[model samples]
Target: MDIHRFFPPHEGISLSDLSGLCGAELADPSQVDRKVTGIGSLSQAGEGEVTFAVSAKNLPDLAKCRAAAVFVTEKMAEHVPSDVAALIVAAPQSAFARAAAILVPDALKPLSFTSDTGISGAATIDPSARLEDGVVVEANAVIAAGVEIGAGSVIAAGAAIGPGTRIGRDCHIGHAATVQHALLGNNVVIHPGARIGQDGFGYVPGPRGLEKVPQIGRVIIQDQVEIGSGTTIDRGALDDTVIGEGTKIDNLVQIAHNVRIGRHCVIVAQVGIAGSATLGNGVMIGGAAGINGHVTIGDGAQIAALSGVAGDVPPGVRWGGQPARPMRGFLQDAAAANARAFGKKERKRGGED
Candidate 1:
């Protein structure tokens, strides 16, 4: 595993430097100089590789890892063998994530743009706006200033892009997918009729029934983010709604203001995330799941379909039911209720308890 493949030569960071930069206490500095070809899970890592032990449960597998270096937490450092080099860090997962970036190849260049192509003349484009080859901006597509588009990305008719909306190469913005005053990373697919950066659901109860509030914030969508059809992501009342990298939002999902969705989160169809709700990384929200305002769903949490989440969810837990509860608890409750109903029916028929 020559380290050159993992870390870009342009980055100027060698495997030897990773130890110091990540606050890792190396077991064998000699191995630190060894080149790493790739990154993988502890169970699958090969020689000249680097992997991370994210939790105590993974320590047993880490012991037998064939990789040159293993990122382990302070608590698990004692378990790491002296023979295998260890990159001891407080947060092994974070360190491993940083290492993965060094290994993965950068995005490829955009396709070539043909001189004679369909482009909206009425569109206001900045000098820095990167229009890739074969990219089409339909009639009345408002490409605002400083918008950079990757190759083969298409903007449909009447679609609007706010300032600094960076669309990745090869992505598509569907018909009338309105994005304003926001920042978007690469490989983002925004479906038709999706309204991004709209006003949030905010109203003050005054002498009248309700008074509307002004929404003045923006949305920040990271790389590889996909927004489905008819989904509406509202701008913050005062702040912003940020969708982390690699998050996939399904069709007809409603995301309110100031919502912070972590990386790799999956939001299924018809899911409604209320204002100020925060979801941690790797959270999976099922179809028709309704998250109440101000809820905090921890990392790796799973919300079942049609569940109404009103409270904070702990990390690595699965929840379900109308008012969301632990999946096991919800199942047990349903079983017990059915049993009680059966017992009542037996008693009514003159059977003994």
Candidate 2:
């Protein structure tokens, strides 16, 4: 497919300009004026487009590429077609990513889902709600009393902003999302179906039954944080649950009460962080990892997919396993366990002998 039919193509950026934008060098100055209007994969890119090749495996594809320009390292530069402009860079993929930001800027953030220029007539805005000049409240959205939304923010269709909530400028609350008892910073993005500021799973055994504890705390999402679709962040029990600036949480994640996630952390999809868990800056958690309650993951640590974290993770290390531990020990244990279960026969992935 033609993605241009859906996302549309950029007007055009010359190869000379793209080299500077991507921090790459224009090796062939003669073809510097060649324009790139879009980007595609190695096998799929056509005329007036750009792509990148990072390794030897891409040589075959590079030879057949018909794009206007391609980003490559010096070693791979010879494989690029003579007709195609070669933008040489230390990291081809990184250069391509930079180019994508400039080329497909609309894909970076959600735009207006409807034709709404301002607050739609069908939206329910309370008399006490305060919206900035450029705020766009889409159809069927509900703005409760005392809610304050900043300029350039978009409350998409069916979103609900509860009373007294404060949203900063240039934020986007997605379709069908709910925000209550929360304070969102500038440039925050909550994708469609995200549930924010909900009650934590807190209860106590009473004489009659389990009694719900008062969830009086709020969620504080700092600037540039992006919560993915279907993610749920529970409100704190007493203290605020804070997401630091530039942290990106993927879809289907569950962040429980009192969680404090640090700046620039990357939490992958389906991860479950229990109550009171703290993650330090630059910590990267892979998909489906389960973090136990009250645990702390230190800065620059990485957790593998499907791992289970029991306690504190030290700074600047990698951990993986059912009960997560250092990678060295975890790998040894895994090999032994696998041998015992599978008759000590080494096999490739998918059990191929």
Q: Give the per-residue lDDT of model 2 (tens digit) for 1-353.
A: 55678678899999988999899998889988889989899888999889999999998898899888889999888888898899999999999999988988888887677999899999999999999999999999999999999999999999999999999999999999999999999999999999999999999999999999999999999999999999999999999899999999999999999999999999999999999999999999999999999999999999999999999999999999989999999999999998886764544434873
lDDT of 1 at 237: 81
Clash counts per candidate, in order, are 7, 0
TM agreement with the true structure for every prediction: 0.61, 0.94
Query: What's the lDDT of the predicted structure labeled candidate 2?
Result: 0.94
Best by lDDT: 2
Encode model 1's per-residue lDDT on 112-212: one tens digit a residue: 22222458686556666778777788766778778878776778766788777777766767777888767777778887789998788888999978999
State in Å the error of residue 172, model 1: 1.4
> What is the clash tally of candidate 2?
0
Span of ten consecutive residues with least summed lDDT in model 2: 344-353
> Candidate 2: deviation at residue 276, Å?
0.1
